[model samples]
Target: MGLYLPDAIRLHARERGTRAALSCADRTLGYAELHSRTNRLARALLTAARPGSRIGFLARTRTEAGEILIAAAKAGLVTVPLNWRLSEAELTALAQDAGLRVLLTEPEFRSAADAVHAALPGLRLVIIDSPAEQQDRQEQPDPPDSPDPSGPAQAADPAVPGYEAWLAAHPDDDPGRGGRADADEVYLQIYTSGTTGVPKGVLLTHTNFHAERAELEESRWQPGSVALNALPLFHIGGLGLLQMALSAGAHSLLLPDFTPEAAARTIEREGVTHTFLVPSVLHLLTELPGIERRDFSRLHLVSYGAAPITPALLRRSLSVLGCRFQGKYGLTEAGGTVTRLAPEDHRPGGPRSHLLGSVGRPRPGVRVVICDPGTGDPVPPGTVGEIRIASAHNTPGYWNRPQETTELYDARGLLCTGDGGYVDEDGYLFLTDRVKDMIVSGGENVYPTEVESALAEHPAVFEVAVVGVPDDLWGEAVTAVVVPRRDLPRPGEQELIDFVRQRIASYKKPRRVHFVGELPRNPAGKVLKRELRARLRQSHQ
Candidate 1:
């Protein structure tokens, strides 16, 4: 068995040599080649990077994504995958916080990379696109009307260091003096969304990779099965998906980002048999053009999480894809996945139909509890409380923040998940609301999910987010931000409020309903309730 992550790649190369391992666009890398390339890159990186020094990547999901991460793991360097969607200032703050020594840049994010590099002059910036690619980009003529196809239309920036040249300088032989490495060392760092506050970096050790593996090994996906992953590589889902596929030596395809059309086409083209997605992505897949003609028959298991899925959407997915559905629940802090509703748990109308809404019982070697947030006492089953988790797969904690780390974990070695939810009598977990997202009105606690679920039942409602706004009399008034279904007329505030009152308690109904063109979401399809609360404060001010 592999002791560290890099050992897995080495094991695959020796045992599954010449087997196809990864695909991105038109390029595919075999396990042996992938192993060799990672070694070469690791040797080159060793020339500069020291143990614990952070190396960052600001590129989309591509072939280089795996190579960089694998090499970093082997060399004992910490890798930070930057969120390309963040502003230059936000990216700068994260890079500074990580004390980064190197950053790999992609052409699409050249401007942002340049800014980040300028802000941190001491940080080494290595452009993933070569010097010639940069020149070719400059030489391409811009059309009068459309944006430049090659890249940004701005004037050419001076040629900087190229990734290809950097890697080529080192020998392909395994410099047996591998970069620094250890089984317990922090191998990866992923930052939080910073919805509640500044994003903090989460440190994941080599052992942390086992959380999701425990469940994935039991999945129906076969060895060498073809799989496609469209989640952003920066997120835990994306990186963990790659590791999961590699665990079984499965053939993997990665996309730069998710698009319903690309995902459908890739599944059909690659004959992909397994894939995982967020609920939002699944909804978009259902809405794709020519979706009726798309061949999803090859898909064996379809897993989704990172956000809730309504029964309506789940029904649509089952009808459209004709595949077994798995509902998953996890957080970045938990490594990848802590629990999942098995495919059998998704029976639409079977005896255990109610389990569809639950994230499912914890997998083997995992422990979970619904506990009081303040006292850390486990609550009885069926009572909502902060979900606490104890697992060897859990991350060590935030990078370089000892105080924050100490506060995150309790004396029992269990960490409060910050998500408020309950466990059923059968040990199934049902999500209620986020602790920070809970609203208090006239001393009554209101979870937005209950109201949102009620409003979502309306035929005209498409997407909805519930928040609490300041009210002179009620202290905090329940407000619903809604996106109306395009095919129907918008529902009125009183009508929807009455709609909720009839379903749940009257106090939980929205006092006001605001229709929106769309809702703001992060990479993982999670609604930004923090942003909505900030908007309410600004309006009242």
Candidate 2:
């Protein structure tokens, strides 16, 4: 097999032409059909635009999404999958910033596509899955001179064309002239919602994917595995798992969207061997009514990340899923994971068990160290400091923010993760809390994660976020926002505070509690601490 992702797909298609390569809701594409369709779409793209051009897809995860991604790879164009949940203004901004030439969208987003087209004059819009006859009718000579009221005549179908029409117009024959792309050539530009500001695009190369696959293959994956795709494809969790599944020549059962019942049904029906998800979704699956009635025997492994998982959730998931539960720690800049808590280490014993709060040890081919936040000097083991990682999987830098890139990626190319954590004597990595999220209370420092973890252990607490709120006496007091478990009695604020206090030090317990229906989170399931902090500040004011 070749190194590039596209080459791998091509090889797989040649070897197993009739084998199913991708599946979505009620749809499956065999290797042959996928390859031929992708090739035709690639030719269409190449004929319409130059190589190395940027193409954006503003659509949900469907069978066509995977095809379009692979097609862009074959066409030598960089594919930018815009998060379908992004607002029109946000989508337009991203399209413009990326300088996308062609935008492929679904019919539901026709208005968004129009907005994008209006904002970006150069973008060509192609509607995927739109009726073929409608495209033809729209293309038919638009009533010779019908531009009396309108300043300029527009295509009846504002979308330039449909994906099928474009593919139909192109020949199936491979365009003999193949383009060369280096390992360092930009492969994907995934934007991360900045905790402090606007989202910034993180540029990842083919080499990054290859490196990640190589590392992952050493431990987690093998050929013929079945991976469940429930995470959003726009985030690292979903895309990273997708790459791993594809690299292994495995079957990926794609979920159009995440729903506990749907995920459990897919796992049972598809014999899903491996899956990645956020802890919130895992919680739902474990606590879903009549969950024991569902068959989880097919699930061999369940990996959760994107947020700190509570020990209760972890233990419950392990027992309920009846599989190995692995935790990975990484960010968008790291291209995904720098460390992973192995399935074996996930057992109940030794430092590994003690370090459940930790994100585990650095993966093979990666080096991690805790350094002084102010000086950037390496700190002694067991000391809480900034976590830094060095690996091939680490992104080179943010797309265009040179200053921020330099700040995070040091001269030695080590990425400063901005998270505070320490490595134990046994080499397990434990995260304390975000340096920015740490609370200074009356000359004492308290980590919100520690308190949040304690609160999560309570039976009635479904989800919780802890942030530092202004306090005249303590300077900053810990405040907890809790989403109670379904139909659970609402515990008094003092009772909740006492529960955490009994478990941890009194000072670390939340001084106040606010019951809410849901914890504010981004689309990726990460708690928006900035928003939490803002809400807490407003409460005091």
Candidate 3:
């Protein structure tokens, strides 16, 4: 009987039925329509799969994607958002691991969906058709404002059900408690992006999501606020942000695909008041041609997370966007965000300028403790250790992986984050490096992030990732892969290495520098250091 995602939307529908609940491109759904549509969609889903079943969604950000998410919650089904950027083999692996029996996909990924279905023939497919197909079905031009409220129109297919027609045929009655939903029910299962290892499903419940309500007040989300989200729905940041906006009865604008030009235009036209973008995207937006001409007056806050932002990129973004900026640090297992670096702490030259590098204090009701890696004991302030979190936002554990789940939590029931960091005397959290990414070069511990931060200050370096490589003298050598700025003259290997030497300890400096056009990254914008380590080691051989 606690506040679940569907329950929150139902309340919004009663209080502000005519207000826009979701938008993408020219399509918008008011709270009333969204409520009714999700109800019907929930019933539709119930007919296809039983309550507590895992439902897979393989597509980008769109209004229909949001519809399915809410509908799944109402129907007491667990929603598993699949990253479309992954390869077919990768998708097949995840589908198999999750044991998906039902999948909702769009025309853009129809072939990929078919491939997965072929692998697991038991999986049923529901396709979100294209506008052209809808136009062909009706033999008339579609209206400007009316762009298929449910989704795109029906495509001619006998094997798979059309999402729009399938949804419309179901009754709009509330599914209610018949689905056996409760606050403790597992509602979402998001897979880790596999930055460090193979992906594992993180199971989150209604209680975990409800904990985010505390953050809405801190974010200053109002009923009239409009948030533009360009991050893929499969990502935790994208889904969590949408939930926070909807929980506050605010409108969420989903950008199906992210292009620098498209996002800029959307913000200007839609008057987006809040948004969340990764550092890489922020860099792209600030570097876009004629970026100064765009109007961002309505933008009140830009919350960035998933990866750390370089000082140069952050400063440029502040000057160009002219809005408050907040930084967050969290993992998928922690249910989204745990800490925030507020706008007041983002100043480049202010008294607290040093705080710009910290991830700020823990959010309300969240406790962060740095623990010794070897002894599992609490570390003193400013001493680097594995980050541990205790909060209602923490997920129960991974799905179907009890062994790993058991290992995830410590004796104190705290989720042990594998990232290496320390809490400063002022309670601000500073990330040094991933525990697995830390290198021991000639008996000295070197954190790659500390080395990378130093190289980022170089004018010639556009982007850089530090990794460890094998050496004869040093058990592991620190190496740097750099993306040089197109406009600036590229520096020599020795010069770049020396540049980092001036900022940090000489031993932490990169022994070798490889200039690349771009560094490999996951969808979440985290550098694939493991991949770099493998490729670099192979080159040395």
Candidate 4:
């Protein structure tokens, strides 16, 4: 009777009983089945976990990953989808920090999960989608009457994954009692990539989902269509797509990882209607050999973000897929997207063509303001500053970090997005650079993204990142890290510098260029500026 996520699944169960809700490995699960599975999972979770328990999910994209999110919500638990791509140290640190009651992961990440469990005495490891259960019973010793303080024996047996046991033991029903769901209660905790240091967990309530769902409900996606979720589930963008697909009662293809060939084949074979990918995925798609020979006629929407799409890439994508594209602007703290550039805004020769470089306008019930970083006042249109978001979908706060939360969300309810950007007169949001990436050279502010964008326009520049290095005369001098396109000849460093100088103010040009084989980026596709800075510092002197 409630409107929580599990309630929505149940709604779809009765509304579209036989429709495929999730598809994996030639097996399509109908809504009725999805509803039953989630209900059973929820009941199992409720039995073992206390209210407000933390359940950490560590796996590549899978149907169960999505299931765990809704299942945890139904049990009044917080689902922390851990990044499986992180190093062992990072993963263990995160597991310890979240203090999870249970860790659900895949056999692929078994070692990582084992390492995490070893570090946290109270942590239980549950490996899904493998022969883990059969071997689990054999490998784990019989439980001793005495509790082990340094092991999962304190709670559940930590040796083996109980994924199958949870399913077989529990009945497929809501338990006919109240669960942990309430309007303002936090439902999910997604950790921010600790690019700066230790990643902070962002706490999002059901209220945020309600707001996000309201906007998702406005999508042009048709009922009973198929969607592709190639982005990692640990990322907000991936989880957002899953939420949208489930709420719409649409069939979704959950991928463990994204490869251009697999994505192309999946789209054609599955008749995918919609998908959201980072620009890197799009780049991979275009670079694929014989891609044009393949079928993509079923594609309806191709939404790309996390980084800006170059004009060259955009044109190639338009010619390749011929589907509507959308660009969105958001961080994990904002719950995926508060502003989106719609398909209409991406049309060539359209009135908004000049603004095509911009990420797009604010989405429904969202307001974007360019605030001066120094004074916390709104900057005039076309003036660069910190981009702030006022939206119903913003996270309540970062978990366990009040000072960081206070800085993130100002007194006026605006979430100060660490991204630096400016709004045009037409209300489009153009990304400049991360506020942390801004360089001060002899009293002038130089944004790296502006210089990088100008460099991206060059034919030979496959990728470029600009960082500042210590300069006695200028305080800090702009430095360009270039990755030349494999198909083209490499350009000289000064030639690249001159290209930027001509495109923007000469002072903003990268004074020195360093050519590299590739630019370092996290899975989300954001350049590792801090790494670049460190490398420069080590090399200098």
> Model 4: which residue pairs collide?
none
Model 4, residue 166: C-alpha shift (Å): 2.3
Top of the candidates by lDDT: 3
CA error at residue 386 for candidate 1, angstroms: 0.8
Clashing pairs in model 3?
A: none
Please list the C-alpha lDDT of all candidates, in the order they appear: 0.81, 0.79, 0.87, 0.80
lDDT of 3 by residue, 1-541 (tens): 2246788888899999999999887788999999999999899888878888899999889988898889998888899999999988899899889888789998888777877888787777898754445556667554465355544333454457878787778999878732224877888899999977899999998877652555777788888999998988998899988888888898999998899999999899989999999988998899899999899999999999898777777888999999999999998898888899988899998888888888889988889999998888999999999999999889999999999999999999989999899999999999988898899999999998788888989988888889999999999999999999998899999999888889989999999999999889998888888899999999999
Give the winner by TM-score.
Answer: 3
**Model 2 lDDT, residue 56, Cα:** 84
* Shift in Å, residue 126, candidate 1: 1.2
Among all windows of 10 consecutive residues in model 1, the one with the lowest summed lDDT is 150-159
- TM-score, structure 2 vs. true: 0.93
For model 1, the stretches where C-alpha displacement exceeds 4 angstroms are: 1-4, 130-159, 175-181, 211-213
- Judged by whole-model lDDT over C-alpha atoms, candidate 4 comes out at 0.80
For model 1, how many clashes? 3
Off by over 4 Å in 2: 130-159, 173-181, 211-223, 349-352
Give the per-residue lDDT of model 1 (tens digit) for 59-173. Answer: 9888888888888887788999999999998898899899888888787888987777777777777778644565576578753653555543233332355677677778776
